[model samples]
Target: MTTTPMPVLEELSAAEALRLMAGVPVGRVVFTEGALPAIRPVHFVLDDGGIVFRIVGAQRLADGLHNTVVAFQTDEYQADRGDGWTVTATGHATRITDQDEIARLARQLPLPWSDRGHMFRIEPELVTGRRLTR
Candidate 1:
């Protein structure tokens, strides 16, 4: 039997990574709470230099009580061929308390997968991405 060739991996530029992230509807958010790490899958919309999302309740990370530095990751990968890209954005997360801004973002972003009452925004200081090519 013939074997498939090894896949090559490449790093994506910050702009390209952001573009890829905007095209997808879902991703995972990682943060630290106390001495442990936590991760949550979330839906987001890109806005200027920040990414915005909505949540239902106090998730500790979103409640403005835990660590502010977090990483938001989005990717699309094919298991069979191992071809696709993954983008991770590191930044500070803060809940949007302004009613007007919330209204504006609500109109721009797609409806969240879950029932969420609060909106949050994260301004990424660094963004990195990687892709596998077959």
Candidate 2:
């Protein structure tokens, strides 16, 4: 007879969570729209202790929602091995309009997938993550 080892579920430290987040370029940004919870997938970069990404100026996301409280989440999972991790960061998001900062971020962001050109930043106030492994 044989028994499979139990999988371990672990909570990653905040630093580790942030480090993991830095490596991921895609995530969901959660927010409230018309009093309803909403989420949008976006490409992002970790910079200056914040998450920065761009959207076209005409997008709904580019509407007057600066300084809104929001959440950003990223995760990876393997169904076959049941091994994966998830990271989430919550904070207030603000539009970054400084030309100099935008230029700096332009160098860091992946090639734009959309046509609009508004940039925003989120300074995470809380970060948490979990990992599962055998």
TM-score, every prediction: 0.88, 0.87
Q: Model 1, 5-95: lDDT tens per residue? A: 8889999999999999999998887877666887777778888889887765566545652238889999998887769999999988888
lDDT of 2 at 79: 89
- Regions more than 4 Å wrong, model 1: 64-67, 112-115
Q: Write the per-residue lDDT of candidate 2 for residues 1-134, one digit (tens) a residue.
A: 76867899999999999888888779888888777898888888888799987755355666645889899999989988879899999999999888888888888888754224778899999999999999
Candidate with the greatest lDDT versus the true structure? 2
Report how far off residue 87 is in candidate 1 (Å).
0.3
Cα lDDT computed for each candidate against the true fold: 0.81, 0.84
Give the clash count for model 2.
Answer: 1
